[model samples]
Target: MTTYKESGVDIAAGEEAVKKIKNDVKKTFNKNVLLDIGGFGGAFNFPVNEYKKPILVSSVDGVGTKLKIAFLSNVHDTIGQCLVNHCTNDILVLGAKPLFFLDYFATDQLKTDVFQSVVKGLTKACIENDCALIGGETAEMPGFYKKDEYDISGTVVGVLDKKNLLSNRQVQKGDILIGLESTGLHTNGYSLARNVLLNKFKIDDYIEDLGCTVAESLLAIHKSYLQPLLPIINNENLHALSHVTGGGIIANTLRVIDKKNEIFIDWDSWERPPIFKLIQDIGNVPEYDMRESMNLGIGMIMIVDSNNLSFFENHLNSVNQSYKIIGNIK
Candidate 1:
């Protein structure tokens, strides 16, 4: 008799993998989570009383080829955290707080330990961001993926009062552009990085400037801004926000700028992190192309009133966040 296991899809392994992560996943739940793991669908109750006009904000993203680094280094946890945080910041730019998150994990064969590690990373971020890790799908397909390789993607849902939505109309000429420092590359540019850096050094090679192995620097978790910015979301001078992602600083910031206004960024304002510097030096990547690709050290950008600079300064300091007054819109 032929069984699914014989076809390379092990049903028992999948069940065991879920069983391992069940407890870790539960820890991320709040009162709003209506259902637990192993259900067909995840349930979350919206706190309607919290907002007079609640608007749902959402984003779907994956960690991209950054997983190549994970696959190379055999470090899976950080990439999962990167996915969660990346999704969090997407809706966060619009003044929303995370409601819940769901993830998709696919692999050629079921690896229980690695799956549990990834789930732990996901639950860790969910707990930190106050988002529910309600449910997710894990696919074990044979011959579809390369041996020992897995892919993960996520969808985040968040809610904020409709009146509190950040918009371009709030952005104006003379608005100060403040940039929040990124934690390394933050899940983008790895394809270029692997092509450039991997060719020059092994994943375990330690560069003096980085003070860590190439893998360590490349695996930095994507930073989430929800906590630091939440306190000032309603500030009148808080014009708009730009979550710097795949397109780098200028392109992402331009998404929220008014047509009548243009931003001037002082590239020299903040120092680029060593990983980026190493990539540039090795690849001789052009300025425009680099900005179009990597975050270049700044992950989140804001257009706020120059008059409220002190207000921002206090909040950033209170949160122990690093920032730079990189430019202005004019």
Candidate 2:
């Protein structure tokens, strides 16, 4: 008999993976999650009376070609964290706190160790963000995917008070831009990074400038700004927040400005992280292309009232979060 297992889609292995990941996922659940992992659909109970007016905020993102680095390095865990954190920040721009998350994981065949490692990453980030891992889908397709190749994507649902919504309307000329330092590349620019460095250097090759191997520097987790900003999101000093991702400083930061207002970045305001400089030096990448493609140094940027820059700076300093006034809205 030509069975599914014979065809290489191991149902038994898939079940085993679910069994292994169930407990770790449950650890991330809150009182709001109404369904568990094996359901036809994930159910989350909205906290109705919690807000004067509740707005549901949602975002879905994958780690992009950055996964190639994870695959090459055999580091699967951080990839999940990158997906969850990326989704969290997308909704956070609208002043939302993540509620619950759903993930999609697929590969040609299941590797339980890799599967569990990725789940651990998702669970860690979900717990840190105070969101539930309500449900996720894992598929083992025989012909669709090749070798050990796999993909992961996540959907994050967050909620916020409508009265506290943030957008371009809040941004005005003369608002200062404060940039939060990134761990490294985060989840974007790996395509270019891999092209420039992968063939020329081994993943373990050491570079003096980066102080780490190519893999270590590239696998840095995309950060979540939820914790620091949540406490001060509604402060009058704040105008809008930008999560710097696929588009670097210029494109992503410009999203919150009115057409009449323009972005004026003091490129020299903060030192570019060494990995970026290496990428440029090796690839001979143009300055503008580098800015448009990579985070450079800043992972997140906040446009705030110029009058309250010192107050906000004091607040951030109290938390010991490294940030710089990189620009102004002109």
Candidate 3:
């Protein structure tokens, strides 16, 4: 007979971690979560009455090498938030309202306290978005990861009315492209960042330009666009939306554009954040590669009717949110 412990995966430790996080996760629960945490599968009680034709939207994502920054800084908490928000925003671009989230954590060893901190971040994000923490998996695989290293991924389920679903098919020529400013790197291009910065300067070394340690700048939490986009999603003038991620602004924005219409971005329209400038200056990374690899400063892009441009600008300004008219479709 094969034993789980002999296979290098400790079922007992995984169980203990679950037991520790069950109550804390429950704090993010809403009426939609019908099942408890330890079940064979998660159960979410969909609000059938809430929609005439409810369509479920789901997305899964990982923190990528941003996890390395978390491990290096000994800050495991916010990575969970990053995972949840990233997944949530992925579906939000389709005009979905998040319902619940599930997470998967895998590591070579189990550290209960560190895992708890990660769960706390997830819980906090779920509460802020009014979503539930339904269920998740915690795996301990001794050979699969380094002793102190772990990775986190999450799945978010959301709802949209069949009539309200947003797709790239709606994108058209003459639509205006608006960009929401990012709060630093927002969880991509870390491998390149680490390769350049770690070779030249220690994490503790303060740069006068950045006014802080390089590690602090690299570890900034990925910002969520849900709050700012929510108010305008129902507006018919909104043509298409894109959430800038690993492929940077061009690739991500193009994903939601119809092939017939080309997107023209004015590179000089927005201010590039200092962290990106630091990486570019030190690494001598080319401008084209920089545009293809990192967000540069814009984390999300909205494709809206030119007629609605003023309305969008007013709403963003009312929230004290900074944005730029990066380009338009032609």
Against the true structure, whose lDDT is highest? 1
lDDT of 2 at 112: 97
Write out the backbone clash pairs for model 1: none
| Model 3: lDDT to the true structure | 0.88
Q: Which stretches of candidate 3 lie over 4 Å from their true place?
A: 1-8
TM-score, prediction 3: 0.95
lDDT of each: 0.90, 0.89, 0.88
- What are the runs in model 1 whose C-alpha is more than 4 Å off? none
Candidate 1: C-alpha lDDT = 0.90
Candidates sorted by TM-score, best first: 1, 2, 3
**TM-score, per-candidate, Cα-based:** 0.98, 0.98, 0.95
* Candidate 3: Cα lDDT at 119: 96
Could you give candidate 1's per-residue lDDT for residues 1-330 as a string of tens digits? Answer: 998899999988898889889999999898999998888999988899999988999999999999999999999888878998999999988888899999999999989988988998999999889999999999999999999999999999999888888872478788898899999999888888899999999998999999999999999999998899889987779999999888888888988987778889999999999989999999998988889999999999978998888889889999999999999998
- Candidate 2 lDDT by residue in tens digits, 165-213: 8862478889999999888889889889999998789998888888989
Pairs in steric clash, model 3: none
